[model samples]
Target: MAAIYQVDSFTKLPFSGNPAGVYISDVEQDYETCIKIAREMNLSETAFPVRTTDDNHYRLRWFTPTTEVPMCGHATLATSWVHFTELGIDGDIYYETLSGQLKVSRIGDDLKMDFPSELPFRIDLDQSIGEALDCNGMAYYSTGTRKLLFEISDRKKLEGLHPDFSKMEKLSVGVPLRGLIVTCKGDGEFDFFSRYFAPWVGINEDPVTGSAHTVLGPFWSERLGKDKLRAYQASQRGGEIRLEILDGNRISIIGNAVTVIRGQMLV
Candidate 1:
């Protein structure tokens, strides 16, 4: 039997964050087995801790319902919670992942993570993106994700968007990554807020994506004048990250994780 741990990462509340399942094992598990478990769990993402390197560090991997991914932030937070809170695992933890080493620390009730920043580049977006979205936007950029980031005038127009998913899928054929539509001036405490949709990655929408903040935190932190600011992901079940931009290459994102479900499964 494998122990299954459900953790809500990047938020303080239970039903208002990105929920991930963490499975811990004493032995190394195959990729196919991990993918099968992820598909069965049917969450946006699942994490597997294959080994404990020391009291404070472990090796981890993340998988979506559709495929195994290189990196996952929210799941990393969730995994840290399972280690420190549930299983009595403690101290500063280091995760060796496909994207490299990730350092996580415990701060009172919240977990803080120092993640690498992915500074976005200005790229040319094709007309197909606009056509597929069925909206006329002024600017577009790509972050190597399937989604093209679209610039718009106001929140009203931004919120009124109803993308043609079928059209988007068809237009995605020469596209770098899925498409993301964002506009400034939304009605929120944070200077800006965003909604993420990546049907191309097999997730139609992510409740609260910590990875997206790699781009977002830097972009907003520069624009908003303060290194520390509040970020709200406007989803049906939303989440928050207290972000602090450090220098140019590093950023600190803070949030809390709650353990929702814990059980063991036959593998």
Candidate 2:
């Protein structure tokens, strides 16, 4: 048996942020077994962290319901939350992942994750994407990751989107990206507002995606002329993220997480 925790990342409140399953094991499990467990959990993404030879370090992997991803931000946050709050591990922790070494630390009530910045390059908007989303945006861009970033002109339009998931999935077939991010200038307390859709990766809409912000932070920082920004993801279950573009092609994603479920995975 192994302990599994369901944590809501990027928000202090329960049921408001992205939920991820964190599976901490005493022994390393094979890739197929991890995939099977991820399928069983059926979350947007599940994280598995195995102990490493180095003290305070672990090899981490993330899996969507359908496929394994190279990196995941919310799941990583959930993993760190489980380690700090549940397992009683303290101080900074290092995660060795497919994307390389990632560092996470606790600060006050928030958990800060140091992730690589993936700035997007401007690209011509595909008509199929417009057809699938049924909206127009300021511009379209693609990051190194398998994701496209769409900058809309209006925040309300970005928030009012009703995408055809099947159409999106069909259109995204064979495309190198996982999903699309629609964003716009925010109002009031938020500097930007955005939403994420990745039907190809088994997630139709991610409530608060930290990894997507890795691209967003730099993109918006250049346009808005500010390195630090407050962003809001306008999903059904909305959440917030504090984004800062750091030096050396890195970014800091700051958010709070709450554990909503704790149990042992009997399987």
Candidate 3:
């Protein structure tokens, strides 16, 4: 049996944001064990944080129900929330992940995560993808993280998309894709609004993604000409994110998480 923490990331209220399972351990969980735990939890992603010899640094990994992903934002936020609140960790928390070394810090009641800024490379829109999303794409960009970004000129079209998940996966037959990001320019409320779909990674839709913002923070900043931006993920259980572009190609993702369940996984 192992302890498991359920946290609602990118929101202050319960059941209104992306829910993630967090398992913190002194020793690393094996690949099979982590997969089993993630499957049991059945969240979009589960975070595994194994302590390192260093004081505050840990090796962090994320897994979906069926496979492991290179980076996960909500799960990472949930893990940090568990540590800072439940476990009583004090100063900055450091995590070594597949993406790179990540750092989390506390500011008042919110958490700030330092992630690499990836301005996606422009690409020609795939007609099949446009058909799958049922919307005309303004521009398309692909990132090194294997995330595909499709920007639409109209926010209403971005919000009203009903994607065919099966076709979304099939459209990138020869391409390596982790997920598809659909976004548009926001109107007064936020700088932009987005929705993420990842049938390829076993998640039909992600409620609130933090990693996706790394690419978005930079992409929108360049277009809007601002270093600071606010975004909203227009999922059913919506969430908000505050972004700040830092020096040296990095972005700060700021959000609040609420711990909803404190229990043990008896698997």
Candidate 4:
């Protein structure tokens, strides 16, 4: 039996941030089992970390209820948190995932993740997207994460705007989009503000998305003229993300996570 846990990423409190299922096992988990467990967990994404010969290194995979994703930040953070705090793993943890080799280092209570940066390319706006989101802004597409980026004019609009999710879903499938990021410049303590929606991937609204910030980090860095910035995800269950733009087209995401649930998978 493997040990399974539920963790809230990017927040210290339970039921905040983004919740992800973490499955820790020594034996290899197959594709069918991964999906089954992911569906059972029913979080935005689940992290399955299978140990390799190296104690600190793992082969990690992430799955949504409906499909596997190439990258997932919050789940990765949850998995590393479990390893570092719960299991007493030491030093920097390494993950061999669909996004290539990634590393996480513990910084006191916070964890910093070395992730690949995804620079978004500007694309012509789709009118249907405006109808779905009920707002209009610049549109960009990221090849690395397959997330569509939209920059609205104000934070209030970004926070207050409600989308017709059904129409949003239709647009995502028809346009073949994986997720949508609605973002704007923060007017207060945070440097930027954003929200994530991905009905096409079984997540209607992710509370705090680390993967979305891969695109957000660079998008803001260029405009803000700063390598390091603070960001807030304005979901109902909100969360904060600290970002640093790195050389070689990479990014660093920093946050804390709390283990909200723990149990053994008996099967």
Best by lDDT: 4
* Cα lDDT listed for each candidate: 0.75, 0.87, 0.89, 0.91
Model 1 gets an lDDT of 0.75
Candidate 2: which pairs clash?
Answer: 146-177, 146-178
lDDT of 1 by residue, 195-215 (tens): 676777678778888777777
Work out how many backbone clashes candidate 4 has. 0
What RMSD value applies to candidate 1? 2.4
Clashes of 3: 0
- Per-residue CA lDDT of model 2 for 1-267, tens digit only, reads 999999999998999899999997888778788889888888899999998998889999999878889879999999999999999888899999998899999998889999998778767665667788898764455545677888878887887899999988877434487778889887869989999998888899999898889888988898899999999999999999998889998999999999999999986
State TM-scores per candidate.
0.89, 0.96, 0.97, 0.97
Return the candidate ranking by TM-score, descending: 3, 4, 2, 1
Off by over 4 Å in 2: 172-175
Q: 1-267, model 4: which lDDT tens digit per residue?
A: 889999999999998999999998888778888989999998989999988888688999999988989999999999999999899999999999999999999989999999999789887764667878888788888877888898889988998988888888777333457899999998768999999999888988999999999999999999889999999999999999999999999999999999999999985
* Selected candidate, larger lDDT, 1 vs 2: 2
On residues 179-244, what C-alpha lDDT tens digit does candidate 3 reach at each position? 888888889879999999999889999999998998889989999999999999999999999999
| Per-prediction CA RMSD (Å) | 2.4, 1.5, 1.2, 1.4
> Quick one: ranking by lDDT, best first?
4, 3, 2, 1
lDDT of 1 at 15: 78
